[model samples]
Target: MSIFSGLQPPEAFAEAALALGPAPLVACHNDADGLSAGAILVKTLQRLGTEPSTRIVGKGENAYSDAFLDELRGRAMTGLVVTDLGVSSRLPDLGLPTVLIDHHVPTGVPTHACVVSGIEDDPIPTSSLLAYRCAKAIGVETGDLLWLAAIGLIGDMADEDGFPEMEEARALGITALRKAVSLVNAPRRTASGDASAALGLLLKADGAKAVLSGAHAETAALLQAKEEVKAALDAARKIGPKVSAEVALIPFSSPCQIHPLVAQAWRTRIRDRIVIAANFGYREGWVHFAARTGEDRDLIAFLAEHRPPGAGEEYGNGHRLASGGALRLADWNHFVHAIGFGPELEAAA
Candidate 1:
């Protein structure tokens, strides 16, 4: 049976939740897909007359932890619904019914939970789309909010042609959808409120049109952050490009907090090479690495197979074509050498 077979459609999921009596504690990732997924589930639960508690965890390493379990134990929620996350973390026993809705490749599906992910037979879909399926199944009026799923699809850079639902979302117009995606992602690392604020705006406003019209002012941080990213991109560009036989590296330090946008910008400019943007996180005493490769190469697999022995101190994760993580300063030379690249860094010693 498909792992997703155990997960019910939206209406059935809602019915099962209703049967459970107590509301769920919804944990979402702090990204466009995750934020939108959480909002969709939370709003649907509210519509079902259950007020669910919610929490946000950082991208990869911080998604599941002892503190997270303790937070859940302290809550009144009787169930757990994790969206756009949990695939990377070992799902621990919370002694409650747990459902994980995620899109990333799972390390291993925990036997203790019902997992909705892109694994084996299941085609990868954004978590927001999965949440919308549930909301639609529940007979909730979702016509207005359907565009929210499209925003996440674009944010994740997923191809929209295959899914008719995504096609319908794309029909809303490209300008609006792209703007909405930028609004969500631009502030994700530098500021906290932009993505949430955009989600709220999309959910409450009159669909995509309203979101497109007002996203600029509401996410003004996006504009400022873009400028900062542009400067970082310039610095990365000036570093020219260093190459090994297998890959290219563009290492630089930014005065502003390193957002995914800056890395993405650098990736677009240097598409000819397998680009690794290593942002120096001076304050944290580590270097955060964002790697982008072509369709033929698997960034995650490469990172796994060539990971530095000293990577024990690093933290982060990402998808196949693109991924990001952090490593301690001490691991710099080992990390470069591990990837079959000669080290060109000043010795930390």
Candidate 2:
């Protein structure tokens, strides 16, 4: 049965996955949870006797973009599985069979694909968890994949949600799992933004210890990437926030993707206001920001109200409490000015 967080029926999504031919493309986001989900999907498809091709959608890349479509067209593929990346409301229909597995708050429903979303579930399951369930529903060897679900759980900060799967996986070893998550997440957050090392580890490792055992070359790469991001974060953390009304904006520039970590670090101290950590150096010509709030307010709605004209579908698309987006320098200027920050706060053109 297709339990995919208990929202979809058994026939809803599994049928679509089963319909796909041998050469299906699995496109997933570049993160610990996303990579874990991709690995799970790979194992599932392999069990079904198909050799699937996996692609990592790095930061700033969209799976549904025209460029992505063009790339997909160039490949000889019969099916597609998109995971972790948020979907466009007006999702385009891929001609071949498709299955979308995700847990983010979707903007709209896709009419053409089997969407296995966990948005409705209380304490929503992460993408890897959903993939695990889907694998189980289709009658695969999920017993060995439990630790993967645990890695995604710890990575997404949902380890405290108390899922039985987590408890079971924890028995295998939680420290290694958490460390594996940090290592697996490191490569994607570095300046290179290549998560192949992390994904490769997930694809081959039998368990959490196997990932951190230093037995594979991928493990060394992951460790190096973690140290790189750590240095960048140390420099960015020294800068404090500039508060305005209920918003506490901490603006800094870093090549590493540490804005989310910065926002989270300051989130507790600025418990009364929304914490926004904006980074100008993560990507050229754009400002990347992460919003976190201790206040029980709808950050998505908050962003919608203050969203600058230039902000596209990329903005305000994550969870209600923690959401962020990238904006061009010009649009970012408008956003900061509108939010009552001065010109000095705007991204330099």
Candidate 3:
């Protein structure tokens, strides 16, 4: 069972992959999953005799923005392939054919684009796995890259083990988790190139050892980030547990901006309760929130039900268990009270 077992790529995708002789522009996100998806697509394109030109979205930016559109317009491309990103509310018509392979909740549907997303019925699979299956469907032999999909799955924290679609990806040992972490943190460790060098490494590396060994700085950064998160979680654990409450809140303030990863780690430690961790940067007059909750306390649904002041629906988006968004400094107290957090608790201990 492949993650893409029954799902089919859009007709435009197959036409562009097979008939369009010119190389395609593959724009992807900078995260580990996005890089993995980008690498898989790059390999598939090369095997089909067309080398793809890869572009990465910057941190804290959406995939479809004015700058990105301007860059796309400058390229002499025949077709476009977007993976692990396409949640933009405003997608400009690029005139050229496009393929969107992603699992994120779409903000708006693009015209003249073939979207391959897992929004309605099927279990969400990482864009990397989806792209690999799409490549295979188009007659590219991608047998060796099944393990790569596992890396994306781990990086995205998308554990679809029980789902029928992820049978093959789940079969691959979870060793890629460490490698995924390295790939994710590499860009954060360096000021320049962000995920550019790391994406190149992933695309060219022979195996997990090659990637992990090459990402020394990234691994160290990840370790430090984890330690910081552990410290925060440990302090939160000392706070009295609320057995009657549906959610547990951990508000923190740190110089480092790693709320999403910290929120995930905190969720793992307190799986029995819904976890909401807010990282406040008072200087910026905003607080970024990362929440983890089960189906009973679906984070996405809660975000949808409660719109933060001065923010749109697009501001809060992600999976069922994990979601994130930001709020203004003025709204912080209101948001906290809305989520049932008391005012007396100290944000940082």
Candidate 4:
């Protein structure tokens, strides 16, 4: 049976909804996967006869900050749904009925009433898929949301071989969705600039149709941006592999619109190798890394084990063999060295 099959909206989820009995508030991560997951949850809740206000808390590592939690608390939310985030730390203090749907390995399960994450049993299913299942358990169906779900899977790097069901689902009709997500996710001239644009679209988009249309339009822009970034990455790849040393630092920048694509391209080229890529943004910074091929190099485990003291698990993902993180420029060297890439790069430097 599919891993997703076992996922049922826990009784606590419905009870929590019933307890709220009216408009609830939702907080979700602010990326393609998180936004997609949030959309699914929101639509599902609406279908179940509840209208909820939704907010994007930000992206990656900052998604689950104490400030975000305080903001939600200030809203007097009766019930809270957190998607694509691991809020184990804040759960104890949240003091409200909550449901958490996430895909990353848990730092610890929330003591809250309902916590559903892929890490519990199935490592293969994406959080979107899990959220879809949870939605179904609560009598909320979103067949139209499949495309967003697929995007979340890809964005979360949950495309491993075991997820044949997800692959098959993606094959059904996800080209447009992928393009849409790619567009919003494409790198930009500035980190905050494109992110701001993407967040605006997410906030304004009404339903699946709107999301699909808006994403498609944005994707066209993304493709154009991708072309430019791809050219830069291609050049970097050509020069990058020849740097016969322990660490190969590929520092290059493109319009922020194509950053994700550039990161994806780098992942492909540096398979099983330790590589770091950074894009300088006008107001913010973006960094990505991959450990493609190596001997017993479990990049995901490495990051999970050594993530910075205060950094949340929201910004990182990988299996034992591969892992990646989004970091601010200030902590760039710290993370780079944490992954043991610094010593390796000393020779190259």
- Give the Cα lDDT of each candidate: 0.65, 0.86, 0.64, 0.56
Badly placed stretches (over 4 Å) of model 4 are: 1-12, 59-61, 157-172, 187-190, 193-247, 253-263, 279-296, 304-322, 326-331, 334-349
Residue-level lDDT of model 2, residues 25-62, one tens digit each, is 89999998999999999999999999999999997777
Superior candidate under lDDT, 2 versus 3:
2
Residue 21 lDDT in model 1?
A: 41
Model 4 RMSD in angstroms:
5.5
Report the C-alpha displacement of residue 102, candidate 4, in angstroms. Answer: 0.4
lDDT of 4: 0.56
Determine which window of 10 residues in candidate 3 has minimal summed lDDT: 3-12
Best by lDDT: 2
Ranking by lDDT: 2, 1, 3, 4
What is candidate 4's lDDT per residue for 138-182, written digit by digit as tens?
A: 665656656656667766666554565466666655665555565
TM-score each candidate: 0.82, 0.96, 0.76, 0.71
Where is model 1 more than 4 Å wrong at Cα? 1-16, 19-22, 59-61, 121-123, 191-195, 215-217, 221-235, 255-273, 310-317, 346-349
Alpha-carbon RMSD, each predicted model: 3.7, 2.6, 5.2, 5.5
Displacement of residue 26 (Cα, Å) in model 2 is: 0.6
Q: What TM-score does structure 2 among the candidates reach?
A: 0.96
Total clashing pairs for each candidate: 1, 1, 0, 14
List model 3 lDDT by residue over 1-349, tens digit each.
5433223353335555664346888888777778888888888888888868998875445566577678788889878888887554366577877778887776666656667765554566778767766776777776667666667766765655454334665554456555554556456323232566667767766556656664444444444544554564455444443322567766666534456656666677776777776666422566767788643666777776666576743356777777877666556666666666666532331
Most accurate candidate by TM-score: 2
